[model samples]
Target: MPLTFIDIERQKNWRIVLFFLVLMALYLLAAALFFAALLPGPLSAEPRFWVFLVIAAALTASIHFWFSASNAVDTVVRRLNAQPPDLKDDVHRMFANIIQELHVVTGAKRNIRCAVIPSLSLNALAAADLKGNAVIAITEGLLSRLSRPQVEAVVAHEAHHILSGDCLETTVAASIFGTFSSAMEKVRYSSSNRLFASPAFLLAWVLLQLGYLVNLFISREREYRADAAAVRMTRNPLALAETLHFLSRGWRGAGFIGSGFEMLCIVNPVATTLDETEGFLPDLLSTHPPIKKRLEILLQMARVSITELDANAERRSGRKGTDAQERYFVMSPARLWQGPFTAGELDALPWLSPLTWVANGKGKTAERAWKDPLLNTIFLRRLAGDGRIESGFTCPVCKQPLVTAAYEGTQIVQCGFCAGTLVENGRIPRIIARTGRERPCTERLNALARSVLQQNQARNIYRKVAARGAGQVPLLPCPKCKNPMFRGFYSTAHLIEVDRCSNCGLTWFDQDELEMLQCLIENRLLPDITVAVKD
Candidate 1:
């Protein structure tokens, strides 16, 4: 309330309240003007004039009530086509836990409901009713891409929306805009059906546009407030800033939530070029702050420079403690477990066997030894000798045999026919990092990929592919665990569809997808564990 955001100089929380009051007065004036224009010439009696004024008042009041009392939360959820999350599902459970933790931090009394949109878009929308019922709906893309801290930061941001009463205000404003827009639509329809048109319809249409703009302005203010509140609550403006920056890389899912519901989301679903002009005019009209501006303000709040943030990220990305030699146990050729050697010792062992099993930790048995992901990957690579593990199965897309190959020190499987690569779940960050360092985009693939996946063009491609049933591809079994894989877009930005195995967390990428992702990573557009998460 006291200018919580560190950078803003003039605006205060009360200014938003004052602005809403002015908007309300403007709405009333517009209603009066609408009715006055509709009046039939000079009224003979004062009572007749009063009647016209009363009718106009009633119409405006009806719209306000229609939106406010009409089960807004449910309407919003339905508009997004979101479903109640299944607690049994791992992703769903993670979301539920994050929301619960945020709720606890905020200490809000009202229970907040959560849902999943089943969308691959990386965004979250918050909505609430006048009665304090609130809900937050998250897209699957967020769960798939963002790390726990980043996600926690995002959930905290939405939670603050609920706590600070932004959801109710924004919801009411959205409802009013929608109702007025619908009224204008009916008027247009009537004009088309009529033999003669009325001039008042033009005035009504203009007024509705003004009303929607006012709602947009208020929504933007609410976003800033929520951002500040979230930082205050979580003490991690860097995470939210990184998240916003990451999301701005390419956000084309606004159409999925529809134009009417776009304002409810954390970031504008509409993808704007990172190079878009930034000034008072654009910021005044936008539903959310410019992504660059938001990042700058957040960085200011964190009291750290972008260089510091990057350095911290690099530090976090260092090798995990498993690299140490004190925890590994290898089996000898005589079938007896050897000393608790380090990872280096195990790697340097004289006789590593396909039959020989190695485990980490003191109590780990041979049965559970393979459960360690690092160990499993290392053992598998060693077993293959030449770093090619045959899957004994053919690629569904190309019908060629799949074999794991070592690339950039990571074991990834590639199909012989299409040359598509299949990578284990936790290995993506490593692959991206190594690829960025070693195979930096020498060609202008960054420019090419960006042009190909430009916001508008990418959005159109998504719509066409989604419409033609191209987004739904047949599933392929996991090469390691043999579990059924789920198919989805890798990122809405790149529009590269992939199949991911939930059981083993492995991702299969078609040939073109691997190339496309290499470009994205080289351009520093991809999310990695060291910078944003721990895998």
Candidate 2:
């Protein structure tokens, strides 16, 4: 058996630590320059004075920030826009359980705080402060998209970082870098044009540049070790390998999790537009190893060839028939039955939702085929729910299934087809309260809104959506009961309206409307739409 990551050579670890210390010295050198510029002529001229200044500054910063680890962890959690996982929520509960299991396996008694970023971006990362407060945060996409095994793989990887003290080092390095960055920014924009008078900013920039490569290299090595450690803990290298492949394939264009923190994440949070070719420059600069290389290593560890693994995965999913022989049908957006395509063909569709009605080879409806234990396991995983069984409820607009999702303290049903959300009965209060009570992440909300609007505009539905506000939209039947739903304003302050089932006490928010509602609540703004006047 190959040696586990935890038992890796100590000499290599010491070498990395030495490199980090060297980087720290360079940072102090840079800070010395900044102090020299800030001080008077004679004092600045004395090299001993500059050295003392840098030491004092470094000590002050380290003492101020490092002593209170909770504050550092809290700052990071807030920066990443993370919230504590609701233990009552199935997904959140499962995530918490995974961390607990990893802790038990590693014999780590330090309580690992768990949080979730309300992002659809598929990423997970670990962070720790000098005083030992540690946090593990995963995105909403990870819970919604990945399987339990995959989630465990991710959690286990993060656990390794925490256990091996990587997260502690990361936090300290980031703090040092951040201090320099703030100083640089202040000096760069200063009104005084004392040409090169403040070499501190210049020195800070140089330290950042030199440290970048070393940091990237060390981060990449840590990732490999984490991968190995996760595999050992999960006893499933294939799951981690598949996760890497899935994440690489699902790369949504960058700026999801924010930059400068990519080194801490399992995968680089910032998406690169550069077409990464087989080259040294990409590998050297990347904070994580190439996906292909990681996959290959995992496959080697699993003792399975690529072809074998692919075949095994298919067999495990119970998908055996060829495209020519099997007949799988799907309901089109027009409510027309379009089919006789094979499972492979059906899978090729870009917009396959759990709400999508699919028929098997025997012409059995998805509802009926879903009863089969074997078929349910395989097909449901490919669907939006990820094989986790959900209570059945149809989307009133698209006439598709809805999945239960826990938001804050309330449980709401989300339409897998239309991307709408339904809050039933007294749940609306909880939903509204959650939004109203908390301080909003204004920048995050704005970025999210901009991204959503850009996507809608790209689809040419921006005009139609804007016009939707001006017209008396026809009422649709309630998803819960077939009663006519009433359209009314969501709040007294906002002009935006939502559909509510009077009888069933259900409120329906259309696609992207939930986000808009949150924004309205955050900013206390009225409807942003303009009415089109006609002659």
Candidate 3:
């Protein structure tokens, strides 16, 4: 177990910096208003005063609600904390059983612990910095409502998280959240009346909106990674699917349940995108993908029959495989895309070169992408910049960074700061060459898209072929096969590492490793045509 107590203090400084920046900006705004009072008398009574007052009143209402919600923990802790921290009985023991099962199956470390909240809200989550220190928390609601398999399914998912180093990742995230939450409490809720009257209340509100948005982006990736890990560990994908099905119908609450972690209770608060008839925001602020999609993925992974499953997947995607046997590779976005690639290709992708002020990977990850282009605005900066990204590291064997590139798309890559892929093991080439028909990942992409879209999807969503720095791969452990990585020469030209895990059977690769793998397949089928074709 590692000491991963939330970095509560450091997080607070960030909140303080944000608070002061907001306060200073507001101070300057007030000073400008005072100076404006010295402006023409006619302008003084311009209805902007009324508008500002209205905004202040709205701010007061918002602050009041914020204050009220902050006390929720007192009630929750008072109720939940008083009970023995651990649940007793078959349901409580179920998590332990699941953890034990995972340890035996995955050879994961033991000493895992479990806690149950008395509520039957169908929620289960994991926390801790290391295997021995990890804690799995489940709602009493989930235990009462779900089947044994369903409960174990959720536990297995959490077990994979603990094994995959998510505990440490989350400990870090919690530190940030804890600091922000604490500072927010100090600035906006010291007293109900004082908070309502102060402009800092409104300022804090704005800051929270932004902070949560940023947090959601990071959190979602970890969730998917956890899901992928679970599938590998248990090979019981339907456990998760079954669990989610039960969860969507979990405890129904009256009225609006506020946003954020509370909303992320395994089962998310149901929301539909706003249309002309209903008022709702897009899913961008959402903490997780729609429950429907999550289940769809698990159900696919739980395929009792891979051939039938792949066929169904293909139909849903509305196209036969471009090649009889091929799967697309994986991707992770660059810091919003000055992209991570070998340095030599940087010149051709000028827009991709993080050199210009506008596109430089900056801000949230200065060490990752350098200074943010938006933050360092000089008129000429956007036009010419080399997106120097020294952070947001990726695995040397994968050459891909962890990222969330779109609201609907899975968190795949655009690039990374440091990346490596060992293809010497036969797995990379085999993974690329093999059709997921034998082992599909979330149903074929094309099949799912077409079924959902009610039309045939675009041609070859996967890239064709890719190369970097003289077309070479290094020797390392295979990301997919876990064997000594093998570098295979595809056709006569394309070469790639078998980038996948052998133990769990999940594949790993950056961007179009699939396409390069695919191109090799195609060139083998049509060797004469390829030489005739030009880039």
TM-score of each model, in listed order: 0.50, 0.52, 0.37
Output the better candidate (1/3) by TM-score.
1
Q: Model 2 TM-score?
A: 0.52
lDDT of 3 by residue, 218-275 (tens): 3444456566656665667866676666566555321222233343244444433321
Q: Which lDDT value does model 1 have at 117? A: 85
Off by over 4 Å in 2: 1-13, 16-20, 36-52, 64-71, 186-200, 216-219, 271-285, 303-535
Overall lDDT per candidate, in order of appearance? 0.67, 0.67, 0.44
Model 1 deviation from native, Cα RMSD in Å: 26.5
- Model 3 spans with C-alpha error above 4 angstroms: 1-88, 106-110, 129-132, 171-197, 252-260, 263-265, 269-284, 303-535
Report the candidate with higher TM-score, 1 versus 2: 2
Candidate 1: C-alpha lDDT: 0.67
Q: Write the per-residue lDDT of candidate 2 for residues 92-123, one digit (tens) a residue.
A: 99998988887677556667889998888788
lDDT minimum window of 10 residues, candidate 2: 526-535
TM-score of 1: 0.50
lDDT of 1 by residue, 1-535 (tens): 4543232322335645775575566566566655654555553448877777867776776676555535778877776788888899887888889888865764546688988888888888888876667898888887666777787778878876766666666776665555556655655566453312445545655676777566445545567777877787678898888788668765548667665566678887876552244666655666676666777889999887877766665465453343334476777878888877766676677665333576667666664334455554555555467656677655655434578677777777877535678887788878767765555664666665555455434544546656644334446777666666787667655455678888877788876566567777566563221322112
